[model samples]
Target: VGTLTFKDAPSMVTEFAAVMKKMASYKHSIGTGDTNATDETRVVDGKIYLIINPVNYYDIVARLTIQNANGVFVTNMPFISPDHIIQSVDVPVNKLIVFIENGYDATQSQPEKISEYKETFAMKRATLYAIDMLGNGKPVDNYAAQVYDIAIPTSGGSGE
Candidate 1:
């Protein structure tokens, strides 16, 4: 996990929002290979790397695509078994990284077909709900539930 710090919050947010709006209409990279980045790779202050460590267990397979600030496709890295780490070829600061949930072939050395990545269009549009029941057949609903997004890329069980 990593944190982002900005000297000018409002300015940076404004700039980031502008870029994201353009990205909404852009196409992303998928599968294994070089990349599908059509625009110039954006420059950032630093780089973004991922460190995945399993607790009390181990993972078998993992993969995801990283897009740079200039709307460039960086890499579709694959993490195989145990613990793994992936570093983006291009630095990512005012960029977007989509953790794909489906549709990419990992069988061949090079992917024949690619799939789309996951994205969120709106903010705060998601809500959490907590439901509780009393012994006397009374139901209590507290909409104050808080949810977190944890992206842990793992393979489907074990390989035969």
Candidate 2:
């Protein structure tokens, strides 16, 4: 049994997050989609980018435990603190870094319609996560879950 450590890649590095933010905003600027609008009655363009880090542990002892959105330490991944960030070049193929948001229950839902809303939100690819935050406003894995594969392009010039 070994301990597992997980850290939010983007959140850990402000630089990465800024890059994602720029990309998300760029999408909206180009009429992509909107996920950060205040009024639901109006359609908007663009979304706020988000991501998370979930580490799983079978049997382990943690020196630095990682906590979820609920303030509960992820039972699986253990001994992980905020400062723990994985080396970029060493990321595994199958193990992808993604984000998780607290599943919004639509606080204003009727009992009969509650499940429907939850079901839809769970599967909506367009929706971004709204996970509960820790006391310090850091995103914790709630119920909201969104996964995506990204290919970032960099600026460069080839010798002609």
In the range 1-160, model 1's lDDT, one tens digit per residue, is 1222222335435533443333233233443353773433332212222222232112212223346899985533222111223334342323323221121223324334443333344325554343333232211111111111233334356545
lDDT of 1 at 80: 19
Tens digit of per-residue lDDT, candidate 2, span 16-117? 443333223212121236456332121111222232223221111132246888899753221123333232334333233433223233342223322223
> Where does candidate 1 have its weakest 10-residue lDDT segment?
138-147
Predict model 1's lDDT versus the native.
Answer: 0.30
How does each model score on TM-score? 0.20, 0.19
